[model samples]
Target: MFTSRGPTLRELAVQALSSVERGYDLLAPKFDLTPFRTPDRILDETAEALRPLGPFRDGLDVCCGTGAGGRVLRALCRERAVGVDFSAGMLHEARRAHPGAVLVRADARALPFRPVFDLAVSFGAFGHFLPRERPGLFAQVHSALLPGGVFAFPVGAPPHFGTLPYWAMLGFDTVMRVRNRVWRPGFVMYYRTFPLVEVLAELRRTGFDVELTPLEGLGRRPDGTPRCAVVVARRRA
Candidate 1:
């Protein structure tokens, strides 16, 4: 459900056909209005969950689209906070909404800062990165943070195998696959790419001490597993 100012059906159609960068650019103006932006409830819960991990000084938000996670950084960090994203449009919206924070336009695979931040967080952006890209991405984030600094983000549990939500995600990925096969520029959002087991292994390979904390706000499955969890990885000293 989009807000009153969210993208129109026509705009959504246009974005669906465009590459990820170009689509976000086109949707940037109305992005906050869309359901695509990370929900405020998640932000609130994340900030509260991370409270004990602080008092953080410098913070960085990787692939911060329109500053949702960046706002979390602002609360957790006492000193400087910066948000990085490759989308000019998303960064533009982020700048307008978060004037006090510095926004850097760059690929997450190649961050510009070095041993500068104590805390780093990202949300809802890993879908854009292919699984092959995780090692490089995590390494970049690791290189940017000081020793013992954290890089955290939330990951949702896989949906029921045959449920509507599961099928919906499957269909979306199928359509995206077809679209990429037929299109020139590719859009890289997948419903299931970063599995928790593989992700933890990659983080370990990238020199992070990793742990998962259950996020109770999203509730649990019938099996009693957490519906979502925060992957908190600390850079090794």
Candidate 2:
């Protein structure tokens, strides 16, 4: 469900056909109108869940598309908030939205910042990174954070096996697989690749002490497990 200002079907088709960077560039202007932008509700809840962990110093937002996560950083961090992404267009929009924030254009796998930030938050961008790239990506985030720095992001539970949501995710990933196989400059996004157990282990391997806290505002599953959770990974001190 996108607003009228969102990308048209033709525009979305063109974006899907282009490389990830170029596609984001094309979509940057209308990105906030689409469902792709991280919702404010999730951002606020993430900030609330992280409130007790603060007060933090400089904050960094990894892959901060249009700077939605900057608000969370500003709320928690005492000093400045910085946002980084690979797309120039997204950075441009972010600058317009958050003029005071430091917006950097850099690949997430190789961040330019030192161990300066005490807190970091990323939202809804993990799907862009393939499973094999997770280690390097986590390492990059680890390197950018100060010792004992926090890296927090929300992850949803996988849908029930026979549910429509499950089938939809499966179909989407299958189509993406086929598309990448046949198309040039394939867009990398998979819904089912980032399992919680594997992700927690990867964070540990990256030298982060990982913790999961349920975002109670989003409600729970039938089994009483959280429908979504915040993975709070602290870089080893």
Best candidate, TM-score-wise? 2
Give residue 227's error in model 2 in angstroms: 1.7
Predicted structure with the largest lDDT when compared to the true one = 2
Q: Which RMSD does model 1 reach against the true structure?
A: 1.2
Residue-by-residue lDDT tens digits, candidate 2, 1-237 = 988878999999999899999999999999999988888988999999999998898999999989999989989988889999999999999999878779889999999988999998999999999999999999999998999999999998889998999999999999999999999999988888889899999999999999999999999888998888999999999
Q: Residues 19-84, candidate 1, lDDT per residue (tens digit)?
A: 899999999999988888888888877887888998999999999989988778878999988999
- TM for every model, in the order presented, reads 0.96, 0.98
Pairs with backbone N, CA or C atoms under 3 Å apart (clashes), candidate 1: none
Native-vs-model 2 lDDT? Answer: 0.93
Candidate 1, residue 181: the lDDT equals 96
